[model samples]
Target: MAAYSVADGAEVARQVATLPDGGSSDSLCAGAWLSAAGERQAFNDDFTLLAGTVPGPGNKGKTATAFSVSGGSPVSTGPGATASDDRAPVFQSGTSTLWYVTGDRHLTSRDLKQPSAAPADHGTAPGQSFLLAGDRPWVRAPLEVTPDQAAVAPGGTVAVGSNLLWRRTDPAASFAEQNVEPAVLGPSLNGRAPVPGSEAMPACAARLWFDDLSLLCNARNTLLRVTFAPDHSRVDKVETLIPEEQGLIPGAVLSPDGRSLAFLREWAGTVDLYRLDLSAGAAPVRIASLAAGAPTGSGGVGRDVRVIAWQ
Candidate 1:
């Protein structure tokens, strides 16, 4: 794994740990959640999960069940048979919050610091607890909601995806929807090599980044920054930063500080990860490259190194 310092543009790469050689890289990319315990609840293996202090600088402590997706109902060790519909899990220790979008199209949360990094030897057998999601999903979707389409913002606001950008207060509040009328933002990436055999209209999906006063999303390949009205009434302004690409931009996630943006672009079978330092007026830096292809491991299906949570 490599850690890039945004401040100095210095890249430091180190070996995190040798992954189990048994699984394909695609399934190995299933999910990675950094627990408040300071250990990462990474996809331990193809089908099993293990929690231990990732032995390294700044990463220590343990791992545990962040919920399981295998079998029916998406059972969780989250207690009380609290099952969920998705795999993108975000753990924020500050609020002791665990958040994820439910299969029923709602953004749910619970107040539980991840369980202590338990012994992996107990076997990857999922506990009978069966609780996968938080008891109450704070945000509900008028339409189907997908994984990694929700983000928790400051000041008790939750932003979710549903074609239109929606926002609501924390603890199960009504959602206020905002529509964005896309306008041209000049041509696409200046030096970006276009995807081979481009499709006419890029498949549009929205990924959101929300702060107290602003929300940012990528729709129709355009990255738009929006400001909400006082008292969370409505969207007041929509400004385009990165315009729609000619080909496609599959995924994006905002940095923890919400200042930088990381996006993925796949060529043939390899996926490239890039980071845009929004705070710095610097060009987006090429960070890491990953292998993405047909899945064949324990979990035969998973995103192409799709980044679900960042913090």
Candidate 2:
């Protein structure tokens, strides 16, 4: 059954839909963005939906068909539409600029308002790459240290990876080679370590930046709230939001107000959606049962169930 709901967890009317390629929905990769007028617009990677041929592996092809969330026929963004190397397009907040990485790995931006206009190519420096921290674009230097995860602060500070946090004060600046002291995890509630003793704790990858100094992260199967020192030199504190005992949390999206987090948990061949209030000691409540045997994408986030937007 297809489930559609509002932000309040109230079930809304549902309409049946199919992929443009006539393929199972499992192969679809979808995302959402807010328009200038605050309407939620959704896009997906079903090339045929726009009458375009799907690109083969590592080939550049037109993707990203835009549609209304309230219900409407999907529209093609045009023949030139493409996404980043990851097959996902990053929409800039408060603007129609769609930022993505081209097949050559160069950072590119296209204006959705004028879909046919040529995209602006922001050439990456030799041995460098670009990424989106929230809605802001940033360049990672020396590309050798490929970050497993990253997050950007409002003032331009960026934290990459967990354990030994790689940090930089500005987008154009090189990362500080010195290892910042690792975040100290709170004691395990069940007296169990994430891993066996002395094997190194699981890396807590940043999922979303809560503010300029703090972010929400996922370490193994747990959620952590990490706050950095003012100088960005070391972790000031770490609080366990969701313990690892709850099972694997593959993906999560924070509410716009930062008061709640919606995440996907998988176990026993079943996937479920749960929402946790950020309030003190709040627990996650199962909101919906997604699908059985759902396929997970590159980062282990389920492709069958995606949280497009949280109003």
Candidate 3:
């Protein structure tokens, strides 16, 4: 259910998403929404650029995967021989960008609009140029950050671990650490009271609609809604809209009209996609689901399928 993100350079932009590990999940695939169906047709196995075409018998229902690889693979020069991790891919300014860490431990981005053998940089570690600060203790996980375009603070900051930090790349300054203020936690996300010092945020997407600021986060298998001030410096309140008890809510997208949420959930080796009406408070309605005998560790595990973008 986790999603992808976009990495930004000085004047360039790229989007990224991670394919689940081949051993624990399926193969490592990544891309963005590039076709008419509103789904991204990612290259299979490796993180190669793919063309939009019909899938073969072995990949029916995998509408996102229209065809095979169309461009050559990127030059692996960052962390490992291949990519150490495929972080979240995101869309911005009419482009979809994906990120990959190389053997040398550097974050690189690929532009799908114009495939590139060379990717730009943010810095070392996950939060260098990426927006959403991912929370991965096991291995550094990727949280594709979404900036509130209408109201991005001086530096886009998010709750990272016990502290808050900005995910901005500064060629002139080193990364600084900041903390979420106590006053900011005065209100709870849901109706329940917020446990003092217990609200540690995972990777978060802070989006803006006109002057309204809202955020989307995934924690303990539940999706979080935390709206903030116009400048995005402090937390206003928090709400647990999609309760974790339903299932693991990994990938989610707010509808363009801002009326509902489209998400993917996993259980019993199956991943089902659903839509929740945020305004009506109605139960989620099923949209798409994996067929029987589909790949394991899909959906919630973020191995194969993901919600790249929502319209």
Candidate 4:
């Protein structure tokens, strides 16, 4: 096996705002940054969603956005201008669709038919947001929900912050949000709410990876494991990997078989990667380390672990 210098590994450990695929990537600084020209730019694999935040009147800082992309981008269909503030996008395999959560606390999805360059090539308008309740949909969604982060199980079930879990086996249903009783929720990341000095950590249900296990950022500042079974039983266990007094953020990836897990921890203003052997619940093994250099300031966000691969 090959190893890299700390400097080289740091250079390779680039912070990506978005990962469109294994080969290509995009950055919000370039695509989503607000310009003085009053136009917004959003980049996806095939289409770049752009909108002019219509100024004044009822529009103010929002407007009816339009979609555009390069010639080779994916073709969008299904919804109309119903989706706004698309972030943390993830694509389901073998489908002409893209799944993502909107800032409105609704898990809305878009359908793509082919790749394109200009936004007009995307045919569908957009879809309204869906309420995500626990395994059930209500005709009326939550009117007052604002989520900072979201994660999807491998099986496509969606989990939000520590307070709510939502799943829809069929698209015909509405997404619903089930408020988890906080009195009994903890011992794992999902069981606790964000404490002082750690508002950056994602909520328990929001930090999940794979189908059930998720990275749990606990009140003691430790990375742990949280699992939700089919019967809706919840289990919280210490990860025993990536130990930090300040805790691990919501940026962990499980190996394909769930035996090995990769996670990032920020300590003393530096960030590093650690691996754990889950076969016997071994402690985390440090693999690569990163520090924020003078030019590229570095820190972790809720969904910072965009991609991970092994030889």
Maximum-TM-score candidate? 2
Q: Whole-model lDDT for model 3 versus the true structure?
A: 0.38
In the range 1-311, model 2's lDDT, one tens digit per residue, is: 23445344455544444434422211123221111111111232211121112343355443433333334344445455454332234445545565555556666666656767876766652222334544445454222223223444666654543333444544454322233223233333233222112123355555666777776776657777777677665566777887677556645777778888877677655677788899998998888766643455555645345443454
| Higher-lDDT candidate of 2 and 3 | 2
Question: For model 1, which pairs clash?
Answer: 81-130, 82-131, 82-132, 83-132, 108-137, 221-244
How well is each residue in 165-201 modelled by candidate 1, as lDDT tens digits?
A: 3444344423332222221112223343222222222
Better of 3 and 4 by TM-score: 4
Computed on alpha carbons, the lDDT of every model, listed in order, comes to: 0.38, 0.49, 0.38, 0.36
Better of 2 and 3 by TM-score: 2
**Please, what are the lDDT tens digits per residue for candidate 4 over residues 1-311?**
11223223434322212222221212222221111110101232232432111221233322222233322222333334343444333332333334444445444445444434222222221233221222222222222222223334444444443334444445343433333333223323444443222233333333445445443432234545555445444443334344455644435555657677665565555556667677654787767754433212334332232222321
Stretches of candidate 3 above 4 Å error?
1-93, 96-212, 231-234, 298-304
Error of 2 at 284 (Å): 1.9
Error of 1 at 52 (Å): 16
**Stretches of candidate 2 exceeding 4 Å from the true structure:** 1-89, 102-106, 123-129, 134-136, 141-148, 162-164, 169-202, 292-304
Model 2: weakest 10-residue lDDT segment is 32-41
Superposed Cα RMSD, model 1: 12.4
| TM-score of every model versus the real structure | 0.47, 0.62, 0.46, 0.48
How does model 3 score by TM-score? 0.46
Model 3, residue 164: displacement in angstroms?
Answer: 5.3
